[model samples]
Target: MTFLQALWHYPFLQIVMLAGLASAVASGVVGPLVVSRRLAFMAGGIAHSVLGGLGIAHWLGAPPLLGALLAAVASALLIAFASLRIRENEDMLIGALWAVGMAVGIIALAQAPGYSVNLMSYLLGSLLMATRDQVMLMLGLNALMLGLLWLSYRPLAATLFDPEFAALRGVPTGLLYACFLIVVALAVVVLVHTVGLVMVMALVTLPAATARLGTARLPAMMLAACGAALLAVSVGLATAYAGDLPAGATIVLCAALLYLAGLLIRHLMERRRRRSA
Candidate 1:
């Protein structure tokens, strides 16, 4: 069957596509700020930390996503506090949190009955298993993310670019910084279902990084990133379905290829410009 035929005949593919697209847009929305503020490592830390919450939640027979959210938020706040006030090596603190969170999650999952059934999906993503409820949740969360960014664009941008200047101008830099980390945490969760916890970092950062090569404006970069993510998700999903490959890995690989291609194009363009000069 052709790709279009498969998409038309299989309802799950439709759901998967919707979920991937929603998650892609969410990543695009927060990605620029994450890149600008150099929070990719922090984002990765939060993404890894979520597994602990998921495992514990499963053990407790609660909603796993809720557990992931709690873990992500708690880690984000802790990272923020330590970075702002602890006078310690920030990477060490984040690394410690990352390791501890993963250890706790693994221990929790070990005790949970039937943990193996869905473990792969949580770790590596299961886009082919996307359900309507998940797609709905992603859409709702994506909308909320866009709303929050819209409301706080100016102060958030100012705080991200220059915290000291923003603080001097009464922009509540510390509060905004903390709040932004929370936003990043939320974004990571939104992406977990699309790229899984293991590959969330790539999807979250690659689109924005690729967009950065072509534009410096935040708005333009966001639009370009969204477009790039959408293309990657679409192409990857189609390719995965056609080839019977792992959807999350395929999507991430496609995004990574796009980034590399963008880098090559940028380098060539720069060299040409230099030669002309």
Candidate 2:
């Protein structure tokens, strides 16, 4: 059957599409800030560290997502607080936490007898495997995150671009920075189910980076990023269905290709402008 037929005949496919749309919107809105503030490495740390939570959650037979949320928030807060107080060797500190988190997760999961069978899905993700309930939960969480971001856009931008000036103006730059990391953590949690922890960084950064190639304005970048992300997700989903490929890998690959194409276009534009000048 055709891709459209499959989407129409399957409720799970609808859920996958909805989840992608929600992810695209969230990533588009927050991606520029992440890139602007140079938080990509930190975001990667938080994303991979979620494995620790999954390990414990699986051991206790608890919900993995809940465990991931708790662990991610805790990790983000710890890194945020420490980096604020201890400016020395902050990169080393983050790296340590990153390693520890991933090690703990791997040890826990490895110890679980006969658990390796399903581990691939969590590590790589399969959006189609999500139930209706899981999709609804993702949608709700995305809504809450987006609402918080929308309400604090200006102050957040101030902090992101100029923390010192923002603090001088009593914009609570420290608090805002921490809050932004928390939101990044939340986004990581959402993207985890979609793209898996290992590849989440690509999904979070690629579309936004591509958008940055065309515009310097934050609002325009966000809009373009959303459109770019939506295009990637839609094309990826269709390609995966047609090619019988893994959804997460396919989506990430598509986004990467799109980013490379955008980069080339931007380079060409720059060359033309220089020639004209």
Candidate 3:
């Protein structure tokens, strides 16, 4: 059967589509800020750190998503606090957290005998396996994220573009920055089930990066990024279904291709502008 037929006949496929869209929306909303503030590495660190929580949750027979949420938030907070006080060793700290979190998770999962944990699913996600409950949870979390971002848009924009000036203007740049990290943590956890921890960074950042090549305005960039992400997700899902491939990896590949195309378009635009000048 064709992908459209599969999507129409299978409830799981519908859930997967909804989850992907929700994830894309969250990534689009926060991705511009992530790229603007150069927090991609930090986001990666937090995303990897979620493994520790997942391992422990698996060991305890609890929900993996809960564990991932706790670990991601904790890591984000730690990194945010340390970056504020010890700006010099920020990358070092994130690197340490990333390694330690993965190690801890591996050990925790190893301790749980008799239950074979599907590391592949967690490491390289299968959106086809996404459940209705997961889609619902993703929708709810995306709504919350959107509300928070909307309320703080101006201050967040100021902080991203000019933190010192924002602070001078009494915008609470430090607190806002910390809160933004927490939001990133939340988004990472929510997306873990959709894209997996290994590839979450690409999904969260690539769309915004592509959009940046075409527009300098944050609002416009976000809209364009969302469109790019939606395109990647839709095409990737259909391709994965048709080819019997890994959905998460396919989506990342599609996003990468989009970025490369954007770069080429930007280069051509620059050449045209120079010629006109």
Which candidate number would show the highest lDDT if scored against the true structure?
3
User: On residues 61-163, what C-alpha lDDT tens digit does candidate 1 reach at each position?
Assistant: 9877789889999998998888888766779988887898888888898898863646778889878887898788778777777887888889989988888
For residues 60-96, write the lDDT of model 2, one tens digit per residue: 7887888888888888888878878675465776787
Instruction: Check candidate 3 and list the clashing pairs.
Output: none
Candidate 3 per-residue lDDT over residues 1-277, each given as its tens digit: 9999998999888888998898888888888889988889989999999999999999998878889988988998898788787674889988998999989998888897667887878888767887887778778878878887888889988987888999899998878887888889888987788789899999989999999998889999999889999889998999999998999999999999999999998889999999999
Pick out the ten consecutive residues of candidate 3 with the lowest summed lDDT. Answer: 79-88
Clashing pairs in 2: none
The model with the greater lDDT, 1 or 2, is 1
The residue ranges of model 3 lying beyond 4 angstroms of the native Cα positions read: 85-88, 273-277
Clash numbers, per candidate? 0, 0, 0
Position 267, candidate 3: lDDT: 89
Predictions ranked by lDDT, top down? 3, 1, 2
Predict model 3's lDDT versus the native: 0.88
Residue 208 of model 3, lDDT score: 94
lDDT for 90 in candidate 1 is 76
